[model samples]
Target: EGRRRGSRAEGGAAFETARCPLPPAVPDLLGRDAELARLRAEAAADAPGGVVVSIVGHPGVGKTTLAVSAAHELASRYPDGSLAVDLRGTDDRPLSPRAALEQLLGALGLPARQIPASEPEQSQLFRSLLAGRRVLVLLDNAADEAQVRPLIAAAPGCLTLITCRRALAGLETARWVWLDPLEAPAAADLLSVIVGPDRVLAEPEAATELVALCGNLPLAVRIAGNRLATRPNWSIAYLAGQLRDERTRLSSLSAGDLQVRSAFEMSYGLLSPSARRVFRRLAAIPGSGFGPELAGVAAGMSAAEVQVRLDELVDVNLVQAAVIPGRYQLHDLLRIFAGERLEAEEEAAERSARSEELLSYLLRTATIAGRAFDPPVLTAHPFASLDEAAEWLYREASNWRAAQRRAAAAGRHREVVDLAIAMHWYSDGRTQQQPWDEIFALGAESARALGSRREEAALLNFLGWARYFCLGDNEGGRAAHEAALALAVEIGDRTEQAWANASLGSVLTRMGRPEEALEHARRAVDLSGDLPFWLGQGSIRNVLGTILRVLGRPGEALEVHRGLLADIEKHYDEAHPFARRFFHSATLQCIGLAQNETGDWPRAAETFRRARELFGEGGNALEEADAALNEGRARREAGQYEAAAECLRAALRGFTGVAAWWPRARALAELSTVHWLTGDAAAARRYRDEALALCEELGTPQARALACELA
Candidate 1:
């Protein structure tokens, strides 16, 4: 340790002796072992002049702590001395490069009179002093590249470590290390360090919850830990329960001077007015992640303008760029802070207007995207292609779904009904029925409230399909379809009547009542006769063919399905490719079923394969899985056990990926059969056990049948 000593220059001005003034390394530096090791390695690496390492991250992310810790660890490598200084970059009054040079000169043993007044002269003198000597300089809380540029020591054997909240992209020669919030394990370990290990061990679940509530941020965890430590009477669970309130979370994460909010405020204060406005307005959006387009719509800015503003926010770590390109998200705590700022800075009316605008935009865009799957109802929209429309619908689902809820709450029933109606055909391709259940239920209620029986019947038909196919609730589906048919007949809405009859026929067929299903299916085809194939007639015919096959009329079912395919080909247009593919795949699967019933296993396998490919092209994961299941069944009937097992496994994967528990259970049963036939007794038993468990949970007729078979 080089101790400071009083010295006088030739001109009689006194200065303190050059000394290693680095602060003591943090005793419990958790969650930064890899970062510290990398810093040490870089410091020890060979360089012509010196190495400059810049540690960058958001405020309260422990950038300065890491820099200081690394400096202390590598202190012995530099024989001359180590120096540390705080630039106070986030303050209203940041230290200038010239003033920073004055401090560094004093620290380097220069007398006050000998230190040059000009920045360039001082920089040159500082470099000259450290020319041949190995010294470590730690510049903490830097404002920008400009403030840090002059302070860099260019002498050989001198190492400089700089830390800042923002990335100093303008700094050319420095190696950069980015810091993110601590991972859960490391963050919990840090919390355990501050609060006693025994206390954390006693309430492990609360400790995990506490860290997650802190967003695994190091400073928040430290403050929370310190608060728990000071109040010996407070349990970890008690403290966690207190932090659960978002309104008071920031205020709660405080111990003495360590406050998460104050650290965030410093970063927030540095943003431009426009950037700040965008930042706060973003909190009004309903989802965690969004793109520039949504941000632009919310902020009332153009795409270009919002992109520039978003870049500005990302520079300061206020917003993070998502792994998916063109997407960004604010940190959980930052989002809360932004929401607080929005309420504080914006008027009530202005905030309401902004939120309403975003909601309206989301709902309108969603309606347009959903319409891409329904070709006959063409409307002017932003999307250029079906793929783009599908992407937007799935990617922005949370936002649009939130908008639907808001619209319902605000009594905007027409808008809610319109969005739900558009999602009718679109929901068929989605992975789960839960979202569709909520959407169609709200739509049906809104339609009922508005006295629009036709819309209500249509929405109820959709709800029925979701219940029967997606949810595997035959009774619920039959009830919905019956209600929808009653409403449709009362309103003389033939289209809705056709949909209701078709849905009811499918549900009845699944309930092992094909004789009753045949009557409803034929009536659906008749009711849909005036409509085009892509509209409703093709689906009705497919239902009719399926009922015929189930009732032991495979020859008639084959003719019906072939005729339906011919009708589709005759009326197909390239403009409505998704609708065409969807209908074509549906017809092919019916044809495959008829073929399977007629003992044409090879033809059925080929037809199912084609249907699976078509469904895949239409982005219908559930339908594709259905085709695979059918193909596996056909292959098994043909005595192709190995091929059938592969097909069943593929079907299982598709079902599991979409969380379609009923279909997954069905696939598991099919796999068990194939495994049993192939002499894999253990695998067969395992598959049967899983299928029975799923069936026991589902409590559906099909599940009960499968369970009986497994038993």
Candidate 2:
């Protein structure tokens, strides 16, 4: 009786209580009675959040048949209806979790546009939609735990059945059912059901021999039966004799054109010349799966052409279609088959050319995507819009990341350097989300190989930045920046020199060496020379202002930030809003911190509010939390204890969301100060103790100061 709102297109979001209309169950499945009984018992005993029952077997086994039969028999128990999906687990291109979610949601009446872009967000939304609903979700041929995890219902009354070739041992909650090839009786029974029990009974010995020849697999047995059904005159002995050869067993398991190889060859033969070329070339890709767009690059066709051919291949099951549109995968045997064809038909030069083309396409597309976040590159670019670029980056992340490593191994040093350099700004926000040291390390090595000193210096600087800010390796950062400085000095690249000094200053500040940091910051500012407001000068100034504040000259820091902000306002290019907002937020945060230091509490609060807004607008959650913490500090200094507590709590929430422990600890300390000001000694002590412990664990300066104060 439950109802859900449809998307806007479906009658203005009216509720429609509906259930998944599962496909008809396969008929006459043999040797699965025990497995079926086990599945039903488990489903009945499943917890409120549901249970995952994974049916694992080799490819061409009867796993899918058993799952469908079980779901049909147990349909009445789940009134909310049953859903099923093919995950293409045995194929190189298995379905993506996000795409699987989209299908589930679509079946539940949500439209494509309504689905969230990110997998995490989509998963949350899907879970919320399924809350309290009793549903049977059958995920067939799932690739791994990751693909199935997001689709498993959390509702109490739901049951999820998964089928895959591998055991998926990583899914700890799953109940395992390993399907071995059918026993002799079951295999003979399955063939009899497909052909006819009378025919099978008439030649029991031949039937048994034929089933044995088919490897006792349901798919092979069914195909063998199908072949015999069409040729009623052929004796079971004749068929068994035809399949006796092990090498040609698969080839002989055909009825006319329905032969195993014929089934594949027919689909392969039907492909347009270009699609066949791409399909075989794809076997050369190292990754297990690839997106449709990449298939175009591999085939030397346009995106539109690749999609059409991929669909044709999927139609005949030559290629397994992923739940996510635009993704296609081949089964292990199919990939091997494709490789055989590729080796036999294609020239070495042709294979190498296709591989290089794919690499080039991935490199170019990655550069375009990364440019969306980098100020200097995005200022006047026209290849892709920001949204398209960002979408491409996420949707094709695996493709390009693999390509980067492959190209590096192939000694495409210049291309690798170009790709890594383009990611400079984009990498800043993803320090924790990605392992960037590998990319930058390879880039630096490639730059050195190419004898490009400027590229090497930039790569080293980026490497150092990631180490300091993301990994907390201050010593590693210091070494890399020193190398960058040495190289910049030798090459006489003033821009790189400024960047090296500014980057070093930032690292030094974090290491608590304010005086040495100040020396670098001042030189960075002097060398920058106003190339463009946010490009180099603004960056150097922001570090300079921070160093001045730590040196206990808040008045001077405030003066520096004030002048920088005015200059930025005059020269700020609105062309790349994302980059502009990031640079401006840093300025506002510095100015607000300086004001807080000078006891301009009210002004500081206002400045922090602006900085928080800027950070939020730019999607910088960590920086936004820091801004909120500063605002709280300003309010606490102004004696507005209640408001200070509220602001600090907001900062705490933001920090927790991003798991920024250091900032979270600072917010706790600020809340402790607010409690003390409000005369709550017990509350103040509790908060202070927690903050002190966290700071000690983190080895922050706050720990030392708090220890001295307590003593």
Q: Using lDDT, give the best candidate's number.
A: 1
Per-candidate Cα RMSD to the true structure, in Å, reads 23.9, 9.3
Backbone clashes in each candidate structure, one number apiece? 0, 4
Please tell me which predicted candidate would have the highest TM-score against the true structure: 2
Question: Could you give candidate 1's per-residue lDDT for residues 1-711 as a string of tens digits?
Answer: 000000111111122324327756787888898899889889988787699999998777788779988988898998788887667576434666866776677666543333443456456556656767888899888999989998997777889999888889898878888998888999899999998999999999999988877777777777677667867898988877767765554444434222476445545666799999999999888864799999998898988899999998887667888645799876555777888899999999999999988999988889888887675654455678776887888678767887898899999999999999888766654524125677889999999999988889988987887666655578998999999999999989898788788877888988889888889888888898776656667778878888898899999999999998898878877436766786788789889989988899999999999999998897677678889999999999899998899899999887665445677898999999999999999999999999998788667677898899889
- Candidate 1: lDDT over CA atoms? 0.78
**In model 1, which regions exceed 4 Å deviation?**
1-259, 315-317, 377-380, 569-578, 598-711
In the predicted model 1, the residue pairs found to clash are none
Q: What is the TM-score of each candidate against the true structure?
A: 0.58, 0.70
lDDT by residue (436-525, candidate 2, tens digit) is 666788899999999999999989988877666555578998899889989999989887778778877877887888899889888888
Q: How does candidate 2 score on lDDT?
A: 0.74
TM-score of 1: 0.58
